[model samples]
Target: MENRELILSIKDLQISFKTDSGTVSAVRGVNFELHKGETVAIVGESGSGKSVTTKAVMGLLASNAKIEQGSIYYTWNDFHTGEKKEVDLVKLSEEELQKEIRGQKIAMVFQDPMTSLDPTMTIGKQIMEPMIYHYKKSKKEAYEKAVELLQLVGITDAERRMKNYPHQLSGGMRQRIVIAIALSCDPYVLICDEPTTALDVTIQAKILKLIQDIQKKKDLSVIYITHDLGVVAKVADHINVMYAGKIVETGTTEEIFYDPRHPYTWGLLSSMPDLTTNSDELYTIPGTPPNLVKEIKGDAFARRNQYALNIDYRIDPPMFDVKGSDTHKVASWLMHEKAPKVEMPETLKQRIEAMKRGEEV
Candidate 1:
């Protein structure tokens, strides 16, 4: 993996929004890396800063939001000069970002297609708009590319759908169009913020498959912001488990799913329903996330963590390297050598074993 090129690097990203009541700390010291052509998923419950972190990457945060500290370093290869250039996105002005970066280099597919798409515009026009604005393509060229995009997204009758409005398409078709628009400019990085939340179960699976297929076809690096572990399992090459505005765990998908180290990640995996789950009641994480309006002295998840130590209550745990794996890291006191050795729940252990045996779990 060291030989793989780094597409984006985020370090010590802290984002806060100024509300009437007070400042809400949305993303606190979040950090991660996206390598070329890899899929990384940021998973957590609502208000855990999954979407907020991605919004910062896309420069789509609210006007009241302030990026107090951090740097989003993006590296791109100039096709004309064949030179690689790195830019700190945090320093780029809104106009510069709009002109030079957004849509052209980095594109985002929002959660809800209905909200993201304009009902007044035709689907074809919407898909071609970015190409015209960013690529400076003629209307004819943009129209041709739009039709090709619709076909690439598996939409039939691409030429005919160009004249239809957003309301004229089905939910799944609308989402496919949104994806087509995002891919129109051939971006280096693609951000999907809960892209399937509004679709039904079957449609959700199809959308995920579509994204995966397109990523492979275009060799696009992807960042998925989602709370659904099942979706993460299906798409993510790397997994970052976020909790209360901080990343609690970071590892490859196999490590995060099979050998999870953080309590929050354990809770999330346990909550995911599988066919082997025979219990009458579904497992859920106890307690709510901490309020962001107030300052947090210790670990934000300490109160909710059943395996939390006294040290976890006194000081926030730093990201500790997991043994035998340099890539796996967890922010929890339980990872310490002197901490009491605790095992995950028996049910979860059994489920993992069943999954390893190729059973439906």
Candidate 2:
């Protein structure tokens, strides 16, 4: 990945929302980078700030939301001049983002297709609007491209389906249409916010395959915001385990699954349903995430982490490089040299062994 071009870099991002009660710190010093032609999945429980961080990249934060610090640097090549360009997305105005970034250089496919698609508009027109608006293409050209896109997304009878409204299509078909719309202008980066969460398991598999295929065909970088670790095993090249608005662990897919270091990552991996397990009840992480409105003392996840040390309750831990791996990193007092060693649960060890043997766990 070092050789691949860096498409997006987020550094020290801090975001807050003003409520009637007080300000809620939504994102706290979050940092990550996306490379060209790779898929990075951000996984955690709801309200972990996964979607909020990506929304900032697209300039879609709510009016009450404020970015206290940080920069979202985007690097892309100019369409007309073929020159490399880089800009801080946070510094760009809303109008500037609309004209130059959104739907042109970067596009988003939301979780719910029904909400994303306009019920009043025809499918063809909805797909064509981005190209027509961004590239100033003639309606005829846009129409032709729209038909091609419909076919590319695996919708049958492309030209005929273009006339149908959102209600006429099935859930899976509507999601494909949303994907088609996101790719209408050939954007370099695609942010999928739980792209298949609204569909059934079978449909979710198909959508994941479709996105992976399109990524290979288009060489587009992708960011997946999801809580489903099963989905992460299938699609992610790298995984960022976010908890309480901060990334607690980051590593290659293999590292995070087979060599998890952080307690939160262990909890997440342990919660996955194992096929060979004898236990009837499913595992779950204990306790809820801490409220962000109040000032946090020490590690935010300490109250829920069974392996937490005394230092975890008194001081926050910095990101530490894992031993014998360059890609894996974790933030925990247990990673400190002086802290007592802790091991993951035995059941999780067995599950990992099953996975290593090429058996589904």
Candidate 3:
């Protein structure tokens, strides 16, 4: 594999929200690194902190949300100076983030296009706004670039579509417009929060392919926040399996799909529907996620993990390096040397075998 430069790093990120009842810990010591031109997927159930972590990176957290701890280090080459620069995004003020980082260095494509788009604003103006605001480009220059971006994202009749309002386009076209806007600033990093969730299956596939092609063309580093492993299987170079408020497993795409270590990861993979599955009942993880209002002791996933050990209830497990792989790591007692061997469920094993045979699971 070619060595890639690190573009962003999140270290020990802890975030909480001041709810009416009490403080809810939304993210706990989350850490991940993204390299130039790499796509990293953060996958888990709703409320697992995937979106919160990325929101923190973008300085988009709500007023009640607090970053209790951690650092988000972002590196970029200065355009004028031609020198490397690095900053801790967590420490940047809202003003600094707005003026220097958000939408300029890093852009986000939200899940719902309707919510992201201004129904009253023309699509061309929406796409050109960032360029005009950030770069102080003339209207004519920004207009031409906006049209080009629309074409780049595969929107047909770019000039005409630019004149249409948000309500005038279909769901898929709206999403394409959203992608065009995210790329309008020529950001080095793209954060996609379930970008395809609202679209149909065929549209979902097309959008995923479009993002992949755009990433290659622009050499963009992407962070995808989603619950869909199916989408991760297609676009992710690496995977982080989040449970509760922290990542339970981290590995390269092949390692995660073929030899997932954490029980949470096994459950997630087993729940996915394979083409060969004939059972009427769909598989689901047995229990609901733990409440964030209460303090979590030991492993946050211990209560729901079918393969959990006694130690899982008493103490939190450190990230144990998986044997024979440098990139694979899991937070689970099962990885300890003295712990009894517990393999992933047999059904999941069969599914993995099918996947290895070029079948989708």
Candidate 4:
């Protein structure tokens, strides 16, 4: 990990929204890093601040939203000068971000293709728009690049498709077009926020593969914000398990899947569909997420955590280093030597063993 280049680094990011009821704390001191050519996934249920964190990176937060603290530092290589440039995204003005960072350095592929693209514009024009604005390319140059982008994203008959509007294409084709537009500017970092939420199951797998293929080809750093662990299992190199607007566990894919430590992570893993399980009923995490509007004194997930200790109710656990691994970390008192020994669910242990044995689950 130390040998790889860090593409994006976010530290202690806190975001809130002004409302009639009260100030809604959407994100609470979140931190994560994206390395060059790596895929990191933020996994949690709805309202867990997964999308909010990514939106902050894109500087696309709503008018009512407030950035209370933290910085998003992005580092990119200057191809012309062969030098590395670093910028704090939080400190940049909206105009500066639009002109310099957004699209040129970082681009986002949103959840819904139908809503993300302009209904009135042709798909060709939409793809060419960013290239012209950000790269200052001529119309002919942008149009040629747009066609190549469509082909790069696996769209057949690219030239013909360019003339078609978003409504004319199928859901999968529309998503492919959206990806083409994102890649038009040759961004160093790609943020995908529930990118496959609106697609069919088969199409979802294809889109995931396309993104993986493109990431390797472009050597782009990718951040996937989603609630589905199934998706994370397939594409993520690292995983961040979030609960109540905070990351409770972070580790490599192998560490997170085979040796999860946090109770919240255990719940998430157990709740995943296991076809090998004998029981017909599926597992589900008990209790709902805590309200962000209310004050949380102790651990945010303590109420929902089955293995939560007494200390969990009184004090939030700090991120503890997992034994024998530098990359694995969990925010749970169970990691402490003085804490009582607690085992994960028997079913989850069995599932992990089965997976290790090359069984499908």
Candidate 5:
């Protein structure tokens, strides 16, 4: 296989928060890498730490959170030092990271435009903020570039929309403005935190396709944070299945959707409603995610897994290698040699087969 150029590398990463209740570990020993021009998605339910992990990458982790352990390294030519070095993102001072990296090198598009967008300012002013700060462009220059970006994201009334407020535009239009703002800086890596969560289904499809189109045109590496498996299947080149505060499984899109190994991953996939299913009721996985305040012992999913083995109660499963792709890995007792054959839910199996047949699933 041809080696893809590596852009971002995260290894043994852990992030914890010291709240009044207790220390809640949000990310635990998360390891993954992003290659140039590829979209990697962290898919899981709410409170799964998918958003937290990406926030760590963007240096946008909450004030209470601490980088407890591990390294998040990246290779980008320093405008100051004028040389490329493996910079540890976790080690960077807030001042240093904000001054050099954020928006200039690695930009992020937040989920809600209402929260991120400045209601008092025009869309044009908001989009130009990054350009003015990062590139030090004049107002005239920044507005011109902003207009171009608006058009690039398929906002037809670029000039009119640029003058509009967040409330005046539709949900889909606001999302495009957010994308335009993120792209204004010409970032090498774009972190999208549930970029289309608020939109309706049809608009979601268009927004997702717009992101794909933008990524292809710019050859930008992306970290997509989403809970929807359906969206992940369509947009992600690789999928990282997150649960509780750790990544339970990581694999190519096909490998994850078809040959899921972790119990948590199986549950996530199984819970997704099948539009093709003629059945009256939708499938659901049993139980809720564990509380992060307590010490997460063994496998976090063990309490909910029907097929969990004895070892899962005492020892946390280390990441195990899967065949074919050395990149494919799963943290589950099911991968151990002594474990019995536990098949995925038949619904998932049928869905995978349907996907292979190039049909809707």
Candidate 6:
């Protein structure tokens, strides 16, 4: 069984994609660690580099994308010695990564289940695919385990679903199959890249619950990549809030939701689709992210940040400590002595106050 004591650790990672136009920096100096069985949500909007960061961890980056810097370390039980030791995954070659870890140890539940599963392959075959490739399990044994996996993922009538193809199942069922495949090998780390993105609200909730249940039961470290704060609130133990190509703020889920110090996070939480609020006019972080091709001389969110102090325009704020546990940190000019004490949005202030009061918000 996987342990909850802590697992993958990614530090100071930088990644950029080489395009014809020039290099587009997708992930820049990202830092976060995933504890064993800990559900760490990488929350950010589209183009925020959440997926790309995890993709670098998986050794799944495209040929054009170069992982410019940083270390990704993993701790696993040594079968022979039965001792735990940290392995530097970033140093592993492409072949070694694919051969030794990838799915067998650290698996990924990709976004868009339909595209992930082969149209030609049956549900059972798709679920069994990873085992065959990594575990070298025989067809019969793999098939039997595949059925059990389907059943484990809450797929009723597993035998029936096993015979069906991706196009045959509903969106929810397809998603379950994706989870089943990711878990077929009982991987230590599960990187779920927006598994609920394409599903409806009802399905999204169900899938989220299913993953939580599985995590509790199997003790899987999950790196959840999504822009949905609702989903993050539901499952995340620790939250890493990403913006542009960097992590602007990070803390426990409660910290991010209640005491969020970053302007971008404020915009996200305030913009939640609450009925009382004007959902018709969703609050957005104004202006665009910095163009990475060109050098970023200042804080990347300076243009969009309503609370950007003058210093933000010229200086890139390093992550500064905040009024919380050591884990809580934010990169903002306001933390500096020279920066102004801009007030947080009233809605966020109210929300934080409500949280402190233990009132229903």
| Candidate maximizing lDDT | 2
Q: Candidate 4, after superposition: displacement of residue 169 in Å?
A: 0.7
| lDDT for each residue of candidate 4 in 1-361, tens digit (9 for 90 to 100) | 4438998899999999999889999999998899999999999999999999998998999999999999999998789999999988999999999999888889999999998999999999999999899889999999999999999999999999999999899999999998999999999899999999999999999999999999989888999999888899899999999888889999999999999999889899998888888898889989999889998978998888878889999998899999899889998999999999999999999999998998888
Give per-residue CA lDDT, model 2, range 296-354, as digits (tens).
89999999999988888999899999999988999998998998988899999999999
lDDT of 6 by residue, 73-191 (tens): 88887778999878888899999999888888999988899888899988888888788998899999999999998888898999888899899889999999989998988898899
* Candidate 1 lDDT by residue in tens digits, 1-361: 4437899999999999999979999999999999999999999999999988888888889999999999999998999999999999999999999998898899999989999899999999999999999889999999999999999999999999999999999999999999999999999899999999999999999999999999989989999999898899899999999988899999999999889889888898888887887687789989889999999878999899898888888899999999999789999999999999999988889888887787875
How well is each residue in 72-174 modelled by candidate 3, as lDDT tens digits? Answer: 9999999999999999999899999999999999999999999999999999999999999999999999999999999998988999998999999999999
Q: For model 4, give the RMSD to the true fold.
A: 1.1
Determine which window of 10 residues in candidate 4 has minimal summed lDDT: 1-10
Better candidate by TM-score, 5 or 6 = 5
Clashes of each: 0, 0, 0, 0, 0, 3
**Which tens-of-lDDT digit does each residue in 135-242 have in candidate 5?**
899999998999899999999978888888898989999999988988988988999999998999999999999999999899889999998888998899999989
Q: Tell me the TM-score of each prediction against the true structure.
A: 0.98, 0.99, 0.99, 0.98, 0.96, 0.94
Q: What is the lDDT of candidate 5?
A: 0.87
Q: Which residue pairs clash in candidate 3?
A: none
Candidate 4: stretches off by over 4 Å: 1-3
- The lDDT for every candidate, in the order shown, is 0.92, 0.95, 0.94, 0.92, 0.87, 0.86
Model 3 residue 301 lDDT score: 91
